[model samples]
Target: MNMQVWASLFGVVLGGLLSYLAQFTTVRVAGRNEERRQAAQRAEARRAERLELLREFVTIAQEGIRVAEERDQAPDWAAAGTPEWFAAGRSVIDRLWVAERMIQILFPPRLYRLARTYASAVDHVLWRLPDQIAAEGSMWHHLRDPQHEFLEAARTELGAHP
Candidate 1:
């Protein structure tokens, strides 16, 4: 081939190669970006789920505390031993126990331990007799510290710490 023809042929080959490389790189980069976006979405979904579980657990814990307080404050009713009151207290404890198990399965060890401690405290309060509560100056009062600790840990874990 003539010199001019040879140069044109080489130029075409080089341009085609460069174009292919650019397209390849663009596709690879786009693929990576998409993968990263999906990963981030999955992580956000998991965080939202954890937050919801924590909210439920906290609600159950609060209910347990309320039941304990009611039993403690209403000495006459407690002494009369109405089945409904005991039943309510037992139901609260049951729900709290289930919530604690959920936390143990879904949360880290530190958070689970805190949840266990808080649950135990609530259980103690719920099971205490009125006389025992009076002697101890309110079992719910004793539960406050553990509840606060669990809440703080949960907030930190959920990245909503204040």
Candidate 2:
């Protein structure tokens, strides 16, 4: 081949290789950036989901406390000792248990256990109280301290009065 023709072919081949390398590097960098962006988006979505679950858990807890308050306030003749009253009271306890279970589904066991102590206490009271109180009268005083502590803990943990 002529020297000029050989030099021309070398230049074309070298230019093609350089162009291919540039394109490859550009694609790799773009792919990495896109992957990082997608990872960040997924993390944000998971955080939002966690917050929603916490809100639901807090709401359920508040409802239980409210039912307890209502039950405590009812008059002896105003449906205090009836089966419906117990059912209403029991429902509040039931809801708390459900919330605890839901939390287990939504979060790690360690976090759920943090709230479980209070939940278990409330649950025990609800289940074991009816027969005990029926014989011994309402142990209303027993509820006061635990309720206060639970409310405080809940507020501190959830950043709300729930």
TM per candidate: 0.87, 0.68
Mark the 10 consecutive residues where model 1 has the least summed lDDT.
72-81
Residue 139, model 1: Cα distance from true site in angstroms:
2.2
**Over 4 Å off, model 1:** 2-5
Displacement of residue 79 (Cα, Å) in model 2 is 2.3
- Which clashing pairs does model 2 show? none
Full-model lDDT, candidate 1:
0.86
Candidate No. with top lDDT: 1
Model 2 scores what on Cα lDDT? Answer: 0.66
Clashing residue pairs for model 1: none
Cα lDDT for residue 35, candidate 1: 100
lDDT scores in order: 0.86, 0.66
